[model samples]
Target: MKGLIFVELMNFMEEQFGELLTDEVVDAAAIPGDAAFTTIGQYPSAYASRLIGAAADRSNASAAELCRAFGRYLFCRFEVRFPTMIQRYPSARSLLMHVEAHIHEEVRIIYPDARPPTVTALEVDDALHVVYRSDRPFAHIAYGLVDQCIASYGEQSTVEWCEGNDDSHARFIIRSLHRSAA
Candidate 1:
């Protein structure tokens, strides 16, 4: 994982939970180098899992839930950091459809060592089907990102997690709801 992710996670923890809780969580996780992260560096992915686990234990929230929330928060940060990439798409579905071929490609160009997940979106029966594949067990975070993306586009949609063959795979079905005249 890239250090940028760690830095963002730290920022998310501090902003949402507070500096005290963030410190406690980091201390509990016992990440190497005392949790000091540089945006351009790379670290063990396990550090991220441990931090999330510690935060979950302290906050009384499930790890999956925490990951999802973090994903949503992360998306907002991405929007602020990469406005041009986000602005190119008019809707969440549009952005998702090109995540793998475009966005992730751009990410790889900027952060050569970054290992991002494979996100592919397909349109079927008027709904968007997003497939997420990664060695890391962070599908819930992807779900959260998709959820927030839809909401950010001012679109009415429900995101559902479909079955996956294993931990490394997940499918999300996003269906837009059409509202009738009042």
Candidate 2:
């Protein structure tokens, strides 16, 4: 995983929870790297899992919920850090569609060893269908990203997600809703 993610997760914990809780989570994680992280460095993805698990244990929140919240924060971080990458898209659907081919590709070019999820988006009936396949089971996080993406466009959307036959895959179907004529 990218250290940037770990750094963001730590920041999320510190700000949302507290500095002491952040240290506790890191300590409970007991992973190799501990809490040391550099934005441009890489570490085992499992460390992130442990950090989230530790936070879940302390906060009495499900790991999925925590991951989803982190996803929302992650999207906001991207908006501030990489405005051009996201601002180029006119709609949430457009951004989701290009993630695998464009965004991940760029990540690979910049960090050759980085392993990111493979996302593919298609339109089915009236909804945008997205399939996310990755070794890491973090679809809840993806769901949050999709939710915030639509919100960022000032559009109302509902997302339904289902796990694949296995943990390595997930499908997200998002339907745009008509806002009331207020």
lDDT of 2 by residue, 67-139 (tens): 8898888888888877888999998889999999998888789788889899899988788898878988777
Task: Indicate which candidate wins on lDDT.
Answer: 1
Score every model by TM-score: 0.94, 0.92
Report every candidate's CA lDDT. 0.88, 0.84
Which pairs of residues collide in candidate 1? none
- Alpha carbon deviation, residue 25, candidate 1 (Å): 0.9
Task: Name the weakest run of 10 consecutive residues (lDDT summed) in model 2.
Answer: 161-170
TM-score of 2: 0.92
In model 2, what lDDT does residue 111 have?
82
